[model samples]
Target: HLERLRALAREVGLEAPLYTCTAWGGAAVPAEGFLPMHAAYPFTPWEPDPSFEPVPSREFLFRSPQQPAADWWQAGAFRYPIERYPYAYCELGAGIQMTYLHRPLVPPECTQALAVVALGSGCNWLGYYMYHGGSNPPGRRGFLNEFTVPRLSYDFQAPLGEYGQLHASYHRLRLIHLFLAEFGDRLAPLPVVLPPGASTLKPQVTNVLRYAARAHQDQGFLFLSVYQDHAETADLEGIALEVLLPQERLRLPHEGSLRLLRGMSAILPVGLELGDGLRLRYATAQPLTVLHARERRCVVFFAPDGLQPEFALARQGCRALTVQGGSSAEEGETLYAWPLPGLGTRLEATGLSGRGVELLVLSQEQALRCWKVRLAGTEYLLLTESEGAAWVDAGEERLTVCWQGEAQLDLLSYPRLPSSLPATGLLEDRGTAGVFWRYRLQCPPWKARWSLEQPEPQVVRLRLAAEALEGVRDLFLRVDCVADVGQAFLDGHLVADYFGSDLPWIIGLKRFAQPGRELELILRFTPLQANAPVLRYFTRERLPLPASDGTLPVTVRAVQLVPEYGIELPWQE
Candidate 1:
């Protein structure tokens, strides 16, 4: 298959590395295998059919709180030539769709912790499966899907929803992505070194600290995961975690111990050069990203929840210091200890080379809102109050920012500001938030509502306000139902089908939209056996179906129509 793909790629002008996928072992037998780390690597993902486990592919990283996997095998990172193929994961389960038998809604925090655990376990490159969700395209016969998945909707419960709406996981996962964008090139080559207890630390052990390091000789990142899916663990309190380096081990937080609240993860810096001359001994806060102004470069960091943001700067390399928005104290006479507030804190120091090195700290929430965008020639961080996906087309002289839910835009640039950013529509310059130019967009909670009508029994018909499709690039239908199964028909043809297990299934409506033709979505309910053994299996997984009179109710609880629009503006200089 890959050979034919390579041939096709050559015939066309497409450039993509080709590799066959395989799984060590999974629910989706042939499909469920270890996705090769990359197209370059020999490994490929083998996804099994009907896998509903939150962290299904890598069973070793998590142990169920209710039932610990004391004997779960750890063959996720298969034994392969290390030098030739780096132990990397391009498809980690940041989020997996709940199957029919298992309806576990994976918490965003668990996905974040999973990424950290993968990194701690020596994964250099990190990628996620179903970071975005979509519905399966209909085949010549019916919908494109396996037996276990839904007929039409493959929501996957991912960061990006079926209609490109951002989920909470999108913001939570970007925290690590921004860090990797800045430091991954340096972290990639560092060999993973697991400390004795940290390596063997099982998922069920709450008392023991789980940690590992990616280091060369001394400089490295201390990675830790405090959360596990399908498990309840005690909070790791007042623990001064130890990071094992190749040369020697060192205790983090030069002064006090920190607590690891369940559902949090971190990658702390160790012996890293902040700039040209300044050397960081260690830091309690996670590095977010570096912002560059033509005149100065400011390294941004986010303080992890439940821990004070602190940095240990080595005195040997430091020459002069100037603090802004916070204070720094001398820890003994060796290193400068700077305890920082989450936001509005800056440390401008002249290192041994007398070059300016700037460090900026933002609250975790603020960091989550930040999106790095390249406008004109300067790099700017588009800090949004809510998730607002942005697109900048310099050639077209347009800037389009789209929002599904609530939205607030704050523009900040480094090195150079745009020649002019005219605030139009709902955008107005509310003034500067330190370096951020805040704007409040007046958008309603909902653009349109879907009116439900049952023209006949066991049948549902929907009507939307005309305004729903007025300026929408695309419109998606959010449907809630109480039934076992349902089939959607368009002009008497079976277009889509749904299993009523997952509430609020989003179906894209644009595909069925035909110009100058009326679009009618008629749904017929044909539920599964109310007493089906499969449903009993689903009950055992903890998502109980309240069976009524031995018949699944074909009731549509709520129907909503959400329109996604890209607010177009003249391209900012």
Candidate 2:
């Protein structure tokens, strides 16, 4: 219970507001990303069961309540939304969605309405699905079912549609955000005033007696599910809605009187109106923000006991701008600015994902210069103090440099850059002992090709000659360059070069290319440095090997997985 959590916090001398509230809704029911979205077309995942029998918990399957109770207790159990219990309300079916941001085409009116309700109720902080769609990464484990998975486009009718096209939903949410820039403060502490006997939508009896008494204020409130389809307009006093569906209205059941009680501050229900006709999928309330606008201004809808902002925007005319103090700041704090002479006329802030902080320069109205900075440790300081101003539009998280101003800023969600790989270490695997060193080459992200520089024609020559030991191939064996880079030999007998080409995932892997018996293997590497330095080396006198049967094959052992290092034996299929 929340009481236990609060007690635990107090016992440890821990401060309140220990955790930020977040929603668990996703494309699937179990709330796990790995789970298949489409129940009908689930991927038969590899189960770790030892009996060779399929494990229900590990694998994906479908179950319906209509089936016999015995079947319900079968291998995989059926799961229904919590809203189905106590009341037969349809709106609380299962799988609800709240649109904080969405793609174009979705009605702006609906998004705005939802935002208003969310703010009125106490929900804050929002994220949308399919923000920017891109192709799925190369298939790994072949565990992902192609049919069920959306194309790399991720165009799930989101604000940023699949093809990078901006849709109505995108603008709708953007406008709401723009408005939130205006009057978000008014709604932050706005309470949901429910009237009279509205007991049907009340928290289920189980959650009330079990979770309500011990709930933590910092943890926020609970979202109770009711077995209702769409929350039609209910004039009854007890129901306080985050969004209103004015277009469609269903009267409250006249069968019974509204149950008016403080039901319990825990558990709210969310309904997702998908496809046409606004058919809703039931979902539990999670801490989230919904933005709406009345006159081209944004207003954030909050869930009761949802997210509460540290500072609300009280001003009316001016647009809300993100101010970064070359540093971190709390929400709703003032920012100050100083002068920067050598660092260009004006310093701007851009690219919040990497480093989570950066500096930029402004030329008139354009972004003239920018720098991507990474923190070496927990924190980094900016010596220069200047005014921090950002162009706070719908989707812009980057801060802009104002001509003159002052402020403090904080970094939220600075996505860390992926770590760098270890240096390539060439190790031998198997070959003629003493004669040949079976070297294995590891490539980094920047290094597209692996190479070998033969300074003395005799080093490789002598190294190859030492192969008199058993299990050693000929000293003058053929050389082969696998993927990407071209191949060249000094012996004039063999020459193969492929430059300016991309490896396509469509063809899988290409194996052992060159054909020759006695040849020296020389590799050439190409590096891609993004505004960074590239180390280089060179050597001379390349030797060649005699030709052999075209039977040698390349084998790819690691497949398409990470560190795709392996022998690429000639594969026909």
Candidate 3:
């Protein structure tokens, strides 16, 4: 069968540079001249017992000869040496989908911690199975998903929601992605070095610190994982770590011990080269990304929630350097900072070899709004927390940015300015209090109306009727309710499902609706258990009843019909 598939690819005009075969289910012989791949998940089915340890399965890490082979492969070709091929993980489960028997809720911090552990464990390539949640389509035989799978919705509670809503995990994972995009090429060939007690630590051990590093060419990244799966961890106090670099052995903090809080993971730099003149000695803060400005290059790093921003710098042949907005002291050849504040921490170092470097330290919340976008072949870094539209400079012309709400420009940052501006002048030197450019713009209104009626004790029937939807491109039925589980049906067909949590419920209605047809939507809701131990453990609040009939209330908030908009730029040739 593998040979036939390879032959079919040749029969067609398909020529792939790399060939890969799935080696996840059981140990199988790799196809000739093909890359072998495996899948990994950090969490399993949630057990009711509080002592349950969530860790990756043994099949994900090791290959065994005594193990049973999968039914698809022959028995003799099942087991082989794993070190012959490059180690890579293609389908690392980012988040788990809830089945009928098991419904496990994964916190956003756990997902980020797992990704850091995978990269630190010498994984050459890291990939996710479902980065975005999606809705399952109808099948000809039956429903597309498996029997235990949810009937309508396939939302895995991923970083991006089913309706393209951004979650907090999206911004947290973006920080990791941006770092990889800048430094991954240099880190690909490095070898993993585990700490002293990392191999002996079990999933239940919370006292022992887990750490790993990658070393190559006198530089390394110390990866620390302070989180354990399905287990509550205590805060580590007065922690001091030692990292062995190529040229020297560096100790972190440089003065006193630092603390590692629960559910926190960071990648600290060791002997990192910042351009030609400056070199980082040691830092507890995690590097986010690098920004290339007109005159200087900005390196942004984030300090964790309760941790202080302490770092050291060593200058080699730089003429003049200054530290502003943060407490600093120098000892011999190294510069140190005790506790850098959340905002306005900059390191301006000048006069040696190339462009000057500015180290910008920000809090985790402030770093979430920083987005890197490319417009007109130029990259722009925007720092705004607004959920509306904004006007930004794209070289000589201005471009408008809009998402899902009212159009407004809250902040603008660019290397150059446009010729014309709005009536509101661009404010400057406001010292981080009010430096945003505000604007108000108009957008199309919602064109559809919907209402819900409870016909049965466990059923909710929603009727949606809309007119002038010809110009509307994307239509959505958004439900804002507080329920346990919801199953949505359109015109007697099971279309989507949703799990009610803190997030909003949304379903795409364009595929099931016509221009003039009345859409009949049915929703079945499930009530939460009053005595469930797991619910109280996570939510901390007791479940309340909406009514005495044990029926969950469902509400249809908005039926939005979104239209397409384009920005016309002035042509320059």
The most accurate candidate by lDDT is: 1
- Predicted structure 1: lDDT: 0.63
TM-scores for the candidates: 0.80, 0.23, 0.80
Tens digit of lDDT per residue, candidate 3, span 319-360?
556777777777777777654644456776663765667777
**Whole-structure CA lDDT of model 2:** 0.24
Provide backbone clash counts, one per model: 25, 95, 1
Question: Compared with the true structure, what per-residue lDDT tens digits does model 2 show for residues 131-240?
Answer: 44333433554323244232222234445433333334454454345334433453333333322222222212222211110012211222222111111221223332
- Runs of candidate 2 with Cα error greater than 4 angstroms are 1-113, 140-147, 195-573
For 349-464, candidate 1 gives per-residue lDDT tens digits of: 77766767887777777777677766665666666554444322333465556655443444443333354555455456566666455565544444454567897757888765
lDDT head-to-head 1 vs 3, winner: 1
User: Which 10 residues in a row give candidate 3 its minimum summed lDDT?
Assistant: 59-68
Count of backbone collisions in candidate 3: 1
Candidate 2 or 1, higher TM-score = 1
Best by TM-score: 1
